[model samples]
Target: MSLSARLEHHLQASGLPFEILTHRYAATALENALMAHVPGDHLAKSVLIHKEDGPMLAVLPANHQLDLSRLQSMIHHPIGLAPESELEDLFDDCSPGAAPPVGAAYDLDTIVDNSLSGLDKVWFEAGDHRTLIEMKGRDFDKLMQDAEHGSICVH
Candidate 1:
């Protein structure tokens, strides 16, 4: 298991130390959290939503789900989930179906769910599904400080 080269470079350049945790093969973020033995609330799950302006990455806890209506209202635009085929091209450096929450690494707009702010720790896919990148919550916050923050996830 490995991180996408692009994401690895982004994390390295950010100067924030992190660790990679390997887990059993899982199909969903919740499964990943379970197999990885991490708190579901602290697992960062990324969803790619697209609109006329382009794609935006919506990040939330694995225990939560994206509230598409809320996001559409916030952005004031019609939006929908990006297709898997499109994601393969956009996140080319990563494995199919696995997306890192760090959208800046892929040059996409990003919005993080407020529920994930100010936690003790956070974990997300390593772009290879079987591995996770773990880091301090403050460090994760610093990386996403510039991204919009909102209640985009339903508890």
Candidate 2:
């Protein structure tokens, strides 16, 4: 099955209500803002980071960037963006620039920005740039229990 199909199955199995949004091309935050007619902050950004110890996934509001230093402290390791070429090996069944927020396929821990707590629901890549998945913040939290919650603000 395709990666998006697997992700759909996973969501169904988890009993989470979600909506899938598709775009003509890469559905980046900028594209999503235009498509959904919402500000960039409403879109969630999922980034894959590699640390000296291991790999981790960070989910933050599109309006903010990940604070590597803070993330390193939170995960207790020196963390940096995973090399673009290594994304496939890092996330099975997912291609480069198409990682999901759940991070289940990567078998890596995830950290979510505390700012997400204010949003009732958020949107994230559904294993592909052309697709997106929207779910409640609480549901997202439940699905990614290994995810750490913190202030990922760059300031």
Candidate 3:
């Protein structure tokens, strides 16, 4: 699928302009960036973390790694990466490793890295390995206005 039904609904409802770019099959965030000809720092990748309350989505640049210690301290809860088995249930509409960063669309809490702020634009997976959604930085900010923001990644 080009996009998750939930994500498509959310995107349209936001009234924000977004472009869907297709690329060769990619298995990882970095691969997605390279295949799409987008800078790794400008491609947002989402990691699902198992938290005390429930699952949380952490968004950061494709080139960075999630700082678990920093994230736990910020959220005040112990967290671990959700296993591959759990992803399908949480993101039933997405490909095995391609989870979109818009947690709100999936009914989950999200925390975005501050590093993405002030960027000119950003790209992210669109529920599949071969399609990417692109949007302006300001539009991204507006879309994620309700999500928490902090430093949660390391090079």
Per-candidate TM vs. native?
A: 0.97, 0.83, 0.98
- Give per-residue CA lDDT, model 1, range 1-155, as digits (tens): 47998899999999998999998888888899999999999999889998898888999999998999999999899999999887888888877878899999999899999988999999998897798999999999998888999989787
> CA lDDT of each candidate?
0.91, 0.70, 0.94
Residue 92 CA displacement from its true place in model 1, Å: 1.2
- In Å, residue 52's CA in model 2 sits off its true spot by 2.1
Candidate 2: segments with Cα more than 4 A from true spot: 1-6
Tens digits of per-residue lDDT, candidate 3, 19-86, equal 99999999999999999999999999999999889899999999999999999999999899999887
Model 2 lDDT tens row, 1-155 = 12455566678888878887776555455565466554567577778788777777888776677888887777677778888766667655654567676766456777888787656777777776567777786777677666688988662
Q: Could you tell me which 10 consecutive residues in candidate 1 have the lowest summed lDDT?
A: 89-98
Best by TM-score: 3
> Could you tell me the TM-score of candidate 2?
0.83
